[model samples]
Target: MKILYINAMGPYEAWPQAGVFVSERVAALRKNGVDVTACSYYQINSPAVQRVVTRNGGPDLGTPIAQQAGVTYGIRKIPNGFFSAAMQRFRPNFWEKRIARQVRRDMEESKADLIHLHWIWPMGLGVMRYCRETGVPYVLTCHGGDIYSDMKDMRKRPYILKMLEGAAAVEFVSKALLESAKELGYSGKNAAVVYNGIRTSVFYPARQEHPGKTVVGFAGVMILRKGIDYLPEIFRRIQELIPGEIHFYMIGSGVLREEIEKKMAGLPVDFLGTIPSEKLAERFNEMDILLLPSRQEGYGCVIKEAQACGAVPIGRDVDGIREAVDGFGSLIAYTGDDDAFISAFAEETAAYVSGEKPIDRAAMEAQAARCSWEERQKDSIAIYQRILGKAD
Candidate 1:
């Protein structure tokens, strides 16, 4: 089957994380003998874009776009300048201002059996509009921001409802995400709870000699939504209760780095900055427990990455996160339950590091298994076939 994949910022923006996901899915489809092609919205004209493309070569548009452009997730790729300007000029939802003639022309040029949309916001929304105008069948995969943002805000509500009404199928990364979609006015017959796949070969479990000191770490951007601001409080509480040696590792670079450093001054923390995707596993293996205290999460792929490295995860008990943690690690309250969270963190940390409760290597393997690219693509292909049959 021939597929035309659409992602507006292109793959260059949602790299390693979102970019890697798309690349692996396309590879799996090829391995299964399905032909896939992609059309990206952003121009691959800059050195920044070219460098990442060189690092991670791609006949597939998504992976190269992300690897070179540095877009890790949907939230990171909210284009601010010209892209945003164009969006304002051509309002996709308002029928008076239909999809641009160029987008429709492009879709027609890249004729395929089906169109698979990765994230339905900014660019994905435009692609969907083109598909609708051309009568080409398409599917929308709900990746956090697309669904979660729609539920809380009215601005994107109509567009999301239209997506539900028109899509051949709807996909959510976790069971919680599925529920969130339903709550957000998606009453589609083809709703599916598909977990994102992790490349086990790239993010494999490693046997590490744990230092006597337990290390708690957070990897990813330094941002408010990630709940990095709460780290200092958690660390201070843990220090007061747990008498054993402890260390903290804060990974990744973002706008909030200065604020995080200011809040965590003089604390037992190692700010390793941002490491390349190839080197992230080493940092995961170094941690006794990985903490993700995000206020919102689509599904914490990092938890899966951490679990793959045999690092226990303790995260905030929010939507997709609870699904990710699901007994593999501890989930605590998002707010107002700091004491409870700190206590649970202490228990899980000491238990794993001290070997009081044997880390379930099998469960870790099981979680990683759920995220394989093959499984993700198999479901995607099946959906494509069904949509094509409907077109017939």
Candidate 2:
């Protein structure tokens, strides 16, 4: 099968967390004997664009375009400058406008059997328009943020409804995401759940010795959406109650680092500062728990990554997080109930810390293995085959 797989970000090295699923899936499909052409938006913010376009610094396009692993990777540059900026205002969906020409170009050039789009917002909407006009078939996959953003703000709800309506098939990372879209009036018949897969090769059961400390770690950008405010308060409360049984380690940096530092002052916290993906599994292995009280998620692949290393996860029971933590870890209600959250965290890790409840490393590893990319691709190829048969 020949597939044109498109998404908002790419080339894994530049946007690791955002591009990983696509990158990995492309490799998996290629391994299974599918001809896949991967395309992504090589964008820089206006400031970076100004720096490059004005000849002040290097170019704004991220990561040099490459073709590797039997998959031809393509880059679509979003044009810059005054006329382009003015041109953008005329379009209701700015991203759709930026991506339309590129999407059309890709479609005409590829002669692909199917087009698999990663998100509903920009790429899917553009593809929807193309399919409606050109009679080409494409599939849409909702990866959390794309659908979640429109759920609260009804301005772009029609675009989402139309995009979902036109797709030959629709995919979701979790069942929760599909239901949420239905709440937004997505009555699509072809939609199904395909959980995001973890790299078990990097993350597996190899418990590192932390020696008398119940290390609970948080690994993600420190931002408002990650439920960052709740971290400091939870840390203080847990420390006051548990009193020296736990040590907090925060990973990844963002705009709120200094603010979080100020709040976490004098606490037993270690700011390791953005560990690389290859080295993150080592950190997970040392942890007894992975605490990310995120406000929303499509599916927390990090939860599965940590679980593969035998670190139980304790997070908010909302969106995709609930499914990721269903049988593996603990989930507190999404009501932002601090007391309830802290209690769940304490209960989930306390027994492990005291050695009363043994960590079922095999069980956790088994759960993580079940969600591997290799396993998920089987279903993806099945979808591709079905869509192709219908197209024939």
Candidate No. with top lDDT:
2
Q: For candidate 1, lDDT tens digit of each residue in 339-390?
A: 6666666566666666776768667756775676676778877878888887
For every model shown, the clashing-pair count is 10, 0
Cα lDDT tens digits, model 2, 312-371, are 888877867878876777776754566777666666556556666676778878878777
Give per-model TM-scores.
Answer: 0.81, 0.86
- In candidate 2, which residue pairs get closer than 3 Å at backbone N, Cα or C atoms, i.e. clash? none
Error of 2 at 286 (Å): 0.6
Lowest lDDT block of 10, candidate 1: 68-77
Model 2 — TM-score against the truth? 0.86
